[model samples]
Each structure stands twice: as structure tokens, then as C-alpha cells.
Target: MLEVKNLAVNYRGVTAVEDVSFRSLPGQIVGVIGPNGAGKSTMVKAILGLVPSTSGVVKFRDRALKQQLNSVAYVPQRSQIDWDYPITVWNVVLMARTVHTGWFREPSRSSQEIVKDALVRVGMLELRSRQIGELSGGQQQRVFLARALAQQAELLFFDEPFVGVDKKTEAIIFEVFEELKSQGKILLVITHDLGTALTKCDQLLLLNKQIIADGSMKEVMTADNIQRAYGDSIFIFNREVV
Candidate 1:
């Protein structure tokens, strides 16, 4: 389980995320949804210790996540990655085990097998030697998913995974989400997609800098909640938010 208490973030004296708190349990996928400038990305960054947090704590198993960074897996928005990095799919997935394999020591056969399984699970095994830059948008996304799976972390974070991907990629991602949940892994995803995909999450965290609502799909996605988080610009009637 993951517990975030009074989490807040400030950048250059300006508050991006303020008084945000939530708890995510295993066997569930939590969606973070909000309008632009809602601090969705900032909040994820803070919890991962990629950015500074002015207040609060992020804990897993009642221990701060900062103390167990290796147990976490993060796949940031695609734009954050340089596709031109000239690295192969196999190398990227293998890097996930570097901490466990040791920087100077060679990877054990078991670790190699784990990575191969991850790639095969994502249907990218045949292209394991291809450079990420050479793959299509959907293929690139699958590569990252394979890398995260290789990590075998208890808690996973994915930011805008469906962006710029084909329908097949989107389906695979959600399928992987269910697979992870069944294994008792926690998943927190940040997505702006307001279509039916929004209904796939076990829970939704609506934000406008502060948490607007956090509950089951039916609870958090009410007409009032959508209007409150996105304003009148986005109307929600008859449960059709988009």
C-alpha cells in the first residue's frame, strides 16, 4: 500500500501542488485526472523524489519511499525520453536490473531470463535488438512498458502512457495494468484522456492543484466533480464527461 499525507510542492516560490493526500492499495489502478496546470505531473514527481516537496510524506508498507527507491518503477511521459538516445530495447530493459545485478558485476542468468520474459510479455521480443529510435511510436511505448515490467517493482507509476500510441498499444497497457494489479502491485497513472478509458481505473484522483475527489469510478466521476475540477468548459451530463 501507498500512503501520501499532506503532500505539497513549490517551484521558485510558487505552489504547484498543495495539501494533496491519498492512499493507493495493492490490486488497484488509480487514475490521476485534472485540467491543465492541475499539478498532476508535479505531484508524481514529488512522490518519486524527482522534485522537492515542501511538506508531507510518501510511504509504502508504512515506510517512506525515499528509503526504498529500488522498489519503485516509473515510466514518465514519452516526451521526457530522448528517442534518439541510440540504445537498443534489450539494453533498456536490462538496465532495470542494474541495481540488483550490481554496476560492476555481471547479471545472473535468472535476471537475463526475467528481462527476456518481460520483452516477450509485451510482444517486443523479436525486436529486442532494435534501437528505440528506430521503432514506431507504439513500439517505443511497448519498450518502456517492458522495461517497467522487468523492474518487478511493487509500486509503478505511468504518466500519459496512452498518448501518441495506437489502439493496440493502449489495449496492451490496460491489459498490463490488470496483470500488475492481480499480482498485488500498485499503479498510479496520470492521464488527460476523458473518454471511456477514464472508466477503467479502480479509483480516480481528481485534482485542480488540490484533490477534488478520490473514490471509485462512479464516486469521483460525478457530474459535479467533473465540473468542479475542469470548470464549465467541460460539461458532464448523463455521465458522459467527454
Candidate 2:
């Protein structure tokens, strides 16, 4: 299980995330949704210790999450990546193994196999030798997905993973997410999608610099919660909330 209690972040005296708390169980996919600048990403970064937290306790399996970093895999927003970095797809996924294999040592045969399997799962094995910058947006996303899979972490975090992908890539990404859940891996995804895709999560965390609601799709998608979080911006889900 992942537990976050009173997680808060500040930027130059301005509170970005305040009094945020949530629990995610294994085999679950939890979606975090909020309007822009609502600290959706900040909350995740705080939990991961990427950003300093004003106050919080984050634990995984009763141990500090910071001590269990090896068990976590994070895929940041696509826009944060440098498309011109001149790296091959195979090498990109292979980098995940460096944490285990060390920077100067050759990857073990098992690690190589894991990388190959990850690429195959995302249907990017054929393009393994291609430069990441040369691939289409969807293909580039798949390469990152492969990198995450190669790590084989128990906890996964994704920020805006579907922002620039094709339908095929979206379908494949969801398919892999479900598979990971079945394997008892927990997923925390930061997304803005409010349509059918949002329903795939087992739980939802609605945010606006703080947790507005945390529950099932039905509970978190209520009209009242929508009004509070998104204000006058109309959002329709399954024609139920408008």
C-alpha cells in the first residue's frame, strides 16, 4: 500500500499543495485530475521527494518511500523530455537497467532480455535501433513506456501520459496499465481526461492545490465536486455529470 498524509508543497511562500492525503492499494490504478496549476504534478513530486515538502509523511508498505526508491518508476510529462537528445530507443530503455547494472558495467543477459521483452510488449522492438527523436509522438511515448516496464517497479507514476498519442498507443497504454494492476502493481496517474478513459481508474483524486475528493469514479465525479474543483467550466461524464 501507498500512504500519503498531510502532504504539502510551497513555491516561494505560496502553497502549491496543501493538506493532501490519500491511500492507494496494490492492484489499483488511481487517477489524479485537476485544473491547470492545481498542483497535481506537485503532489506526486512531493511524494517522490523530487520537491521539498512543507509537511508530509509518505510510506510504502509501512516503510518510508524515500528508502524504497528502487521500487518506483516515474514517467514525467512528455513535454519535459528533450526530443533532440540523440539517443536510440534500445539505449533509452536499457538505461533503466543501469540502476542495477551500474554505469560502467555491461548489462546482465537477464537485463537485456527484460529490455527486449519490454520493447516487444509495447510493439516497439522493430524500432529499437531508431533514434528516439526520429519516432512519431505515439512511438516516442511507447519507448518511455518500455523504459518503465524494463524497470519492473512495483509503484508507477505517470504525468500526462496521453497528451500526445494516437488511439493505438492509448489503447496499448491502457492495456499495459491493466496488466500491471493484475500483477499487484500500483499506479498513480496524473491526467485531465474526463471521458470514458477516466473511468478506467479504480479510484480518483480530484485536486485544486488540495484534494477536493478521493473515491470511486462515481463518488469523485459528482456534480458538486465538479463544481467545486472545476468551477463554471462544464464537464460531462457518461452524460451523468454536467
Candidate 3:
């Protein structure tokens, strides 16, 4: 299980996320939702050690996660990635194995095999030779998904994965999430698609600089909770949950 206790972040003396805590077990797809500037990404970054936390503890099965980052795979928001980099889809995905491959050493046969299998899984094997900048938005996302698969991490983190992709990409990602969860992989996806997330996420973490709600879809999507996270001005016509 993954445990986050009193996770807080400060940027130049400004509080981004504070007093945030949650628990998630394997085989669960957890969605992190909140308005812009609500510190959703900050919280994820803190746990990943990409950003420093003022005070917090992140653990996986009682072990400190920062000490074992090899078990984690993270895909940041699309805009954070540079698409113009002169790299092929194959090389991009191969980069995921760098932790094991090392800077001066060559990738083992196992790493190569894993990359090929990951590309096949994401339906991007045929585009292996193409440059990343040449692919469509959905294809680009697929490439990153392949990279994450190649890592073979126990924990997966995705931020705004569905923002600009087509419906096909969304469907493919959800299918992959279900497959990973069935294999006991825990996933945390930071998303804004509240409508689709209602049915897709196994659990939701509602945040507004702190955790407003955290639980199954039904438990977290209450009208009061929605107001607390997104403010009362936002319309929430569809609150139904399956």
C-alpha cells in the first residue's frame, strides 16, 4: 500500500499544499482532482521527490518511497515535455530503462525486449523509427505510455494524460490502467475530466491546497465536496455515479 502523511509543499515561503494525507492499495486506480493552483501537481511532485516538501512522509509498504524511486514510473503533464527534441519513438521509450542501463553501460537484451514489448502494447511498434515530433497528440501520448510500461514500475503516476488526446487515446489509456491494476500496480492520475473520471476512477482525491475528500467515487463526489474544491461558481449538473 502507498501512504502519504501530512504532505505539504512551500514555494519561496508560499504554501502550495499542506496537511495532505491519503492511503491507496495495489489494484486501485486513484484520481487526484482539484482546480488550477490547488497544488495537485505539487503534491505528486513532492512524493516523487522532484520537488522538496516542507514536511511530510511518503511510504510504500512502510518503506520510504524516495529511497526506492526505481519502483515508480511518472508521466508529467503534456505541456511539461518538449516535443521538438530530435529523438525517435524507440529511443524515447528506451530512456525509461536508463536507471538500470546506466549512463556509460549499454542496455541489456532484457531492456531491449522490454522496450519492444512496451511499444507493441501501446500500438506504437510500427512507428518506432519516426521522430516524436512527427506523431499526432494521441500517438505522442502512446509513446509516453510505452515508456512507462517499459519501466515495469509498481507505482504509476500520470498528470493530465487525457488533456489533448483523442478519444482513442483515452480508451487505450483506460484499458492499460485496468490491465496494470489487475496485475497489482497502483496508479495515481491527476486529471480534470471530472465527467469521465466519475466512472473511470476507482477512488478520487479531491484537493484544494489540501485534501477535501478521498474515497470511492460516490463518497468523494458529493455536492458539498465539489463546492469545497471547485468553488460554488462552477456548475455541476451531472453528479450521478455508477
Candidate 4:
């Protein structure tokens, strides 16, 4: 449902990404995996139109990126958000409606129902009244996920959603992703964990400032492909080499 062609991003004359291209189909979990500074995040930001692309076209469902604004929901890296904000869980999730609902209009009954359902989906309903600063790291992440859920987006972009959380929390988040997939929503998650990406993602995009590989996990996660994307930092010992 999403297409990216010849995407390139430059920052002050330095190319962060060049000639990146990929497509994501509905009901698929596409994982973008690469090491730090590999331009994975830059590609995502360009797709979301958060950063200006030097050259490229991003299309969602036959429409340009700008026309698909509300169709996509972005869950930014938790580290980029200010945790000290005085907003409550309910307030945070409710803010998503500001895009659909005008800034001054009170949320309608349907919007409130959606907010409640989103909190419940993420298991944050009980903490709705609690301040965002009062929650733990995992809980904070869930709140953001709930906000995205409340947005009712057909496509979701998540950046490093499992960065600092514990293993149990990661499992929970994956379960949520599976549920979203079952509901036929397109999911694009930017992850650093190779093992998790191999196991959880339906398709994988191995990137290093460009599209190194893009296909099913079995096709894209080969030893050679991983080595190429990760560079010398990744060890690939083999008896065959000896």
C-alpha cells in the first residue's frame, strides 16, 4: 500500500540516503534493519514527509504523501520524546484526534470511544488518568502506541519501539503488532534487533544508506546479506571458510 522510489535525502550537501526504493503491501509487517547512521531513520522521516527529500517520490494507496497524512500514524523513538511532560495517558491518546477534529472542537462520542478502545488495546485503560511522567519506560511506550492506535491509521511507522524495554515488554509489543497485522493494517517498524526482525517480520528491508536487500526474511536475511549490511562488526564464522 506504500511505494517509495528513488528516494534520496541530503543534509547540508552530504547525502544521508541515496537511491532508496521499496514497497509495503497491506497486512504485512515490514522491518527496516540496519546499524546506526545507515539512513534507516532518514528514509522513514522522508516517507512521512517530516524531512525534505532531495529527490524521490513517496506514494500511499495511489496518492502522494501529503494526501495520505491521516492514513499513516508514526510512533517516534521514545528517546526523542520529552517524558517530563505533565500530560496524562488519556490526554496523550486524545491528542491524536486533534488532526481529525479541529483544535478547538471537543471530542465527539465516537472519538472518546476510540480513545478508550485504544487504551484498552494497549492495556493502558486503567492508567488513563495517571500522569505520563508517573509511568515506567514500558508503560510510556504503550501510551504512545495507544495514541497511534487511536489515530485509526491504515499504515503505521514505528521507530525503534523496542529500544530500551525489557524482553517481556518487547514480547507484549510484538503481540500487539501481530494483532494489528491480523486486522490488515500495514506495519513498518524500524528495528535494530536482527533476530527479532527475522522471527517477527513478514518481510525485511536490509539497508545501508540504500536498499541493500528487500524481500522475504529467508531471501533477505542470508549470511552474505547480513554481513554486507552490518559490515565487519558482525561475525560470520563458518567451518566452510576453514
- State which candidate has the highest lDDT: 2
Off by over 4 Å in 4: 236-242
TM-score: the better of candidates 2 and 3: 2
Model 4: lDDT equals 0.87
Model 1 gets an lDDT of: 0.90
Q: How do all the candidates rank in terms of lDDT, highest first?
A: 2, 3, 1, 4
The digit string of per-residue lDDT tens for model 3 on 1-242 reads 99999999999999999999999999999999999999988999999999999999999979999898988999998888899999999999999999788867898999999999999998999999999999998899999999999999999999888888888888889899899999999999999887775577888999999999999988988888888888876774455542
Give a tens-digit lDDT track for model 1, residues 110-216.
98999999999889999999999999988988989998999999999999898888888898998998999899999999999877567788889999999999998
Off by over 4 Å in 1: 236-242
Error of 3 at 202 (Å): 1.9
lDDT of each: 0.90, 0.92, 0.91, 0.87
* TM-score list, all predictions: 0.95, 0.96, 0.96, 0.93
Give the per-residue lDDT digits (tens) of candidate 4, residues 115-179: 99989887889999999999998888888989988898889999988877778778778988998
| Between candidates 2 and 4, the TM-score winner | 2
Tell how far residue 165 is off in model 4, in angstroms. Answer: 1.8
Cα lDDT of candidate 2 equals 0.92
lDDT per residue (tens digit) for residues 1-242 in model 2: 99999999999999999999999999999999989999988898999999999999999999999999989999988888899999999999999998888989999999999999999999999999999999998898899999999999999999988987889999999999999999999999999778756788998999999899999988888888888998977654334543
RMSD of each: 1.5, 1.3, 1.3, 2.5
Worst 10 residues of 2 by lDDT: 233-242
The prediction achieving the highest TM-score against the true structure is 2
